[model samples]
Target chain A: MKLTIRKDQLNDAIQQVSKASSSRPAIPILGGIKFDVTHQGVTLTASDTDISIQSFIPVENGEFVIAKVERPGSVVLPAKFFVEIVKKLPSDEIEIEVKDHHQTSIRSGSTDIQMVGLDPEEFPVLPTIEESESITVPGDLIKSMIRQTVFAASTSEQTPILTGALWNLSEGQLKFVATDRHRLASRTATVQAENDYKFSNIVISGKTLNELSKLVADDNSEVEIVVTANQVLFKMGNMLFYSRILDGTYPDTSKIIPQNFKTELVLHTKKLMDAIDRAYLMSREEKTNIVRLITQEDGTIEISSSSTELGRVTEQLEVKEFKGESLRIAFNSKYMLDALKVIDSEYLFIGFTGAMSPIIIKPTDHPHSLHLILPYRTTG
Target chain B: MKLTIRKDQLNDAIQQVSKASSSRPAIPILGGIKFDVTHQGVTLTASDTDISIQSFIPVENGEFVIAKVERPGSVVLPAKFFVEIVKKLPSDEIEIEVKDHHQTSIRSGSTDIQMVGLDPEEFPVLPTIEESESITVPGDLIKSMIRQTVFAASTSEQTPILTGALWNLSEGQLKFVATDRHRLASRTATVQAENDYKFSNIVISGKTLNELSKLVADDNSEVEIVVTANQVLFKMGNMLFYSRILDGTYPDTSKIIPQNFKTELVLHTKKLMDAIDRAYLMSREEKTNIVRLITQEDGTIEISSSSTELGRVTEQLEVKEFKGESLRIAFNSKYMLDALKVIDSEYLFIGFTGAMSPIIIKPTDHPHSLHLILPYRTTG
Candidate 1:
């Protein structure tokens, strides 16, 4: 493969594909990145058995020329060293030529690097998915949804299915749910789909979804997602992101979400976040991470935590509004802080069914997203 | 202790002293910061046996009232948690009050934190150094000199003295030198000192100097350094940094630095640095980090490196001046890069003593600093 590409363009494309390349691959050949140069442009692909990513650079895009292909050929190069070399080359234009026996020479400015390349036939073929069952959603919306719910996914490998986030589509509404048994986060948004097209139990690894979110360029750009029996493909601009779906069934979390509350409070999000954060430091020393919240008769809430060796901390914040009953509850401050950060609202609405029941929280401006945390039992 | 202090002033002082506090200390009280409040202001001190740092915030500094001392008292608070709590307090002014049995209450805005404190008598007292054997130098110049030479110090604990930089004073000149057997760096500067006060064989840990460098506020500000039999104290602004000296005899490195060379080259520092940096990446894979430089008859130098598994890279750069004889030599590229990065000149003068002798590097504009790297013997 012979091609002269712009340094910046090639660097960006290499970085995008390198994300899928694993440092330790079960198959040694899987650690390489496949480079294909054709009359149209150059395409780079990398995979690690679970996820595959491919980025393409056209010969000409608008008034700029990203690359020029003199001969159509293909080769696979070690992804780690190849990317680093390309990034540090000291020239605007780089010329790559693959000679006989897969000997590749890269020249830029006064520097020239010759690297050994593997045969492209050794690489695994990219999976093909039908475009018939596809849904279009804004890139920004999907990224936001993934960030809001992905952190709640279980990181342990004991329950493989819990390591992924479930994607459900029904009645033009798309929802994502992730849970680690202790806490759960759910976010819903509207997407453009066919009336009869609906997908359920499509679980993608939270780690893979987070990588895909970073590839999204802008909020207004549309991302097309196609689902098949075993794999899911996300197409954005000139890049394709593909991942394998988990095999197990996701548990029904809707029943656990409380519908009504015996106590409710609304307060500014930043004010409450700051108060709990301070209390968390003290509780962290005790290894419980438990912070207590008590509603005062004067319409204010007191947050406090104590450690046997570090003493205690108490802070009071005036709530915007309170209803139902004044109660005292203890919960993990880290879980509440994580939920509060992604609410995307000035004021947060917190609902409590009882001292032992799950507490539900949502943004006051929008009710599409919700977070649930289980309160800890304390013998006050 | 009862005091109302500005949040920012207290936070800065805590951070400065916290550096001296160790996470794991031989004595438990060494992990805490001693707070001494008087009618003048509050003095914060922390020590970890090897090093001690103290910061004083006066009652009034210029137009800003840093602290208001209502009563005089003393206490010791855990450095780790204390720094974090003060940084996150949500008020411009923080009030710290010590109740009975050293129970301290820290109040800021509506937040209140009660922390358990240790008795001030348990903390070690700060050492006193005589100002008779002191030298004053610009803080910025000393910091630069430390940066230029400290990286060459040996990090291994095998030779404790090598981990420290040798500080020598003679005829109003201060010199610093560090080496790890393979490479050496030396920097010299003129300081204001008593003509009769001359000391040699004084070595301080590179790690301690690096921490002290960060505390230097301004380049033009004077730093008063007092040297004692076992400790050295540096007073910069209102902060005092004290570190124990390494007790050992430093090897003489002057005998190894060659005065004459068979080949000489003067080139742009940045250009040569970039070329060697690229070659170093290839050599790094071979585990030698060795790059070869060959001077051509046309007054240009070729930099190249090859790996058995990864092929090779070669780059040519034009030299501004070439004299003596054409020669080829090999050396560790990392050492060359480090020396090149610290040189404060546009053109670097590189002197090669032969094929196997040490190479000397210095900036063309200054003769006070020098770097030496030993050559690797290649069979070819």
Candidate 2:
């Protein structure tokens, strides 16, 4: 494509699609970013079989002309060099032209880089999303939900299905649930969606959602998510992200969270997080990562962790509120820290179902978010 | 030790000595930080045999009391736990008490940590510097000199002596030279020392100097370096760093640098670095990391690199001053980048004897720093 484009706009477009470009492509063309240039704008796309990202640049953005096209054409350039060189280029505008045999020349300031380009026809075309069933959510909310639930997804490939977060939509409410069997994180949000759209069993890879989170801004600006049988597409202003759904059924984690509580306590989230973090230091060194929480009759809680050879650390905290019977429990400190970190409230509610059952934690004032962790069976 | 000390002061002390504390110490005792507490203040020391660092905190700095001594004692606490827990502790003042059997209790705010302390008698004692000969230099200048030369030291253990930087002190000049055989970096500075004191064969591990670089601030404050037969000590205001000198003969590299130059070119450091950096992108992709620089018959130079399958990048630049004969030279781009990054001058002088000879680069203004790299003999 023969065009001179603003370097900043081109840099942003390159960065947006770079995440989907494979470092070691199974097919050589998969490592290249395909550019389709026209008088309307330039579309840059990259894909690696599982995910594809495309970004668009308009001819003019208000008063500033983003691109001046001499001829409309297509070519695929190596993503690594294209991405890095543009960021380091010295000038405000960069001229890219396709020469004989698809060789591309990028001229900016004093540098002239001639990169061997691939035939655009060799690049895999992104599968079109045909389904009209779509849900809209604020970019900020989706980013937050991904941050809260994605980390709990299993990192191991032993059970490939657990590596994705299950997305469910019904009655204008969108919920995300992720579990690795030991710990689970579930977050619910009221999305802008059709009332009768009841969908379930949609498991999107946590890795894909995490990348999407980085591309989307943390603003209330809207994003439309169109879902098909095996693929999902997210539309953000000038960018489009497409990801393939994992080909398995996500487990029903409905019964994992404890319902009845024997002991319930409320504590300042930051304070509790601080105390547990200190205890986590010892547990991490032990590699067991087990820390104990004990509720006392004196209206307080003690957080402690001990190593056989390294001694113990204990924090006596005067909780904000407490109720129900007293109990002692042990759970993975790292898991607890992760769950607590996502709670955005001043205080958090923690409920224990008699030490053996799963512990449920939630923001004190909200019913939309819940975190559950299985307790360690400690002989106390 | 039984003292209530300011957490910030203690934290700073912990961070300073932490580098000498090995993550996987050879002896169990070496994994602990020895606390020598007296009525005056507290002294923290950590060592992994090869290097030891000791930092002192006094009872008072001017009118502000840093620590209130309740009892005089000594104990060794596990460095891993002690360092992290103190940083996360809730209060400013931490109360430390040594109980029966050397059990240490550290109480701060609502948290209480009891660590198994090793017998202080088992800790290695820092060696006392016996030599009266020493050199003092500004901390900022020494730090700069280390940064400029240390990266050239060999990371491989095959030539153990090349892993250290040779320190040569003659008259009032202190010099550092490091080489991994392929390239060499040398930096020199006049020191604040006795004019007749001359020392040589003091080679400190590059890794040790890198750690020292992190600890010393970028200020023109004075630091005393005391040298003995096999040990070197750096005394900052409140911290003392002791390192063991590597035992081996450094190779004589005096004859390596070319004094008779056929070509001399001076160019803007930043502009040349940028152009070469772009060319490096292609070379890095090819994995050979080789970039070529050719001085043209025209009053300009060209920086370029190419991959057999990926094409080429060329940057033609205007020169401030070029008196070099037309010659083409290739070198490892990464080594050149490393050398250019440490130059504190706006312009740099590059001298070449021939296409096959060593390339010498020095700051255009002064002779405080010099870098030499062997050119790749390209069959062209």
Candidate 3:
């Protein structure tokens, strides 16, 4: 393949796909980024057997020409070397030519780099989705949904299914739920989908979700999600993100979510977070990460943590509205901070269904999202 | 100790001395910061055997009162927990009170932390530096000198002396030199010093130099450096940095610096660095970091590196002046970039004695500093 491409466009395309390139691939060819050249554009593909990413650089973008193809062919260059070379190439215009035996030459400004490439045919092909059941969602909404729920997914490989967040779709409502046994995070939103379309237990790994978030464009752009039996593809502008759904069944979390509350409180999200964040430091020193929250009779919440070796920490925060019984509960402050940081609201509605039951936290403004943390049964 | 101090000032003082506090200490008290409070101010000190740092906050600086001490006493608080707590404290004014048995209470805004502390009496006291001979130099110049020469120091513990850059202060001139056997780097400058007093072979570890660099305020302030037989102290305003000198004789590097050159070239520092930086990426993949430089007859220098697995990279750079014989030499491109990065000049003067001798590099405008790099013996 012989082509001249813009350095910036090539850099962005390489970086987007590089995340999926395997650092330690089972197959040597999997370590490379496959280059598919044609008159229309050049598509760069990389896969690590699980997640595959493909980015395309069209011949023209808007008013400027991004690439000019002299010949159409395919080759797979080392992703590690190619990524770094294009990033530091001293000129705006880069010329690439692949000669016989896959000896590829890249020239920009006064620097010329010659790289030996692998056979592109050896690279694995991405499975094409039927696209019969697909939903379109705003890029920012999808990103926010992933951020709110993905962190609660289990990082351990013991239960491989828990490593992914389940996507539940019914009617026009899209929801995501993730739990690591100790805590659960669920978010719901209305997407631009068919009214009768429904899919459940479509789980994608937390790692893949994070990579997809980066691939999605900014706020105004919309991404189309095409779900298949075992594979899911997110189609954004000029880029496609593909990942395999985690095998096995997702545990039913509906029963664990609390329906009744013994006590409920409304507090400013930032204030409560700031109070719990300070207490987290003391609890972290004890390695238990346990922080206790006690509701006072006069509209205040006292957050405290103590260890024999590290003394004690007490934080007082005033709640906006309190109803029902005054209660005391203890939970992991780290998990609490994580949930609070992503609640895009000024005020939060927190409810407790007794000390042993799960604690529910929901943003008052963005009621579609909710975070749950299991309270620690503390003797104090 | 009982005091109300500005949170920002207290945080700054703690961080400066926290670097000296050992994470794993021979004595447990060394893991804490010793706080001494007086009506005049509050002083914080920490030591890790090899290095000790102390910072003092007076009652007022300019128009702002930093600390108001209610009682005069001393106590030691755990550095790790204490640093994190003060950093996130919610109020500008932090009240610290040391009760009986070193039980310290820290209160800021609505957050209160009681920390289990160690006895201040057990903490190692910093020895008084008998300021017999001292030199005051601009903080930025010393920082720059450390940056220029410290990277060449050996990291391996095999040669303890080589881990430190040798300091030679003679006749109001200060020079720093470091080498790892294969390559050498030297930078020299004129310092404000007594003409009659001279000191040589005072070697300071690269690790300690790096730590000291972070403590130096900025370019405007002057740091008073006190030299002793075993200990060196750098006083920068309210902070005192103490580090022990390495115990060994520094290797003489004067003989390795080639005075007469068989070939000489002057080139733009940034352009040469940019080209070498690109070639370094290719050489790094080969694991040897070998980049060859050949003086072309057309007044251009060709920088290139090649490996069988990663092909080759060639960069052409034009030089302002070329004199004497045309020569070809190879060296580690990583080290070349390091030397060129600190030249502090638009044009760099480089001289080569032969293909196998130490190459001399100096800034055309700044005559005080010099760097010498040993060329690699390559078949090409």
Best by lDDT: 1
Could you tell me which 10 consecutive residues in candidate 1 chain A have the lowest summed lDDT?
A: A22-31
Interface RMSD of 2: 1.1
Q: Report the lDDT tens digits of candidate 3 across residue range B18-127.
A: 99999977767888999989898988999998999999999899888998889999999989888988989989999999998899999999998998988888889797
Which residue pairs in candidate 3 have backbone atoms (N, alpha carbon, C) closer than 3 angstroms, thus clashing?
none
Name model 2 segments beyond 4 Å from true: none
Off by over 4 Å in 3: A297-299
Model 2 agreement with the true structure over B1-380: per-residue lDDT tens digits: 58899999999999889789989888889989999999988999999988899999999999999999988999999898899889899999999999988899999999999889899999998998886877888889889999999999999999999999999999799999999999999999999788689889899999999998888866768889998889999988889999999999999988999987888889899998998898898899789888998888787999999997788999998888877477789999989999999999999999989988999999988999999999888877
lDDT of 3 by residue, A66-114 (tens): 9999999999988988898898888999999999899999999999989
User: Model 3, residue B65: displacement in angstroms?
Assistant: 2.5
lDDT of each: 0.92, 0.91, 0.91
Q: Which scores greater on lDDT, model 1 or model 2? A: 1
lDDT of 2 at B67: 97
RMSD of each: 1.5, 1.4, 1.7
Which pairs of residues collide in model 2?
none
Residue B3 accuracy (lDDT) in model 2? 88
- Candidate 1 is graded, for docking, as high
Interface RMSD of each: 1.1, 1.1, 1.4
- Ranked by lDDT, top first: 1, 2, 3
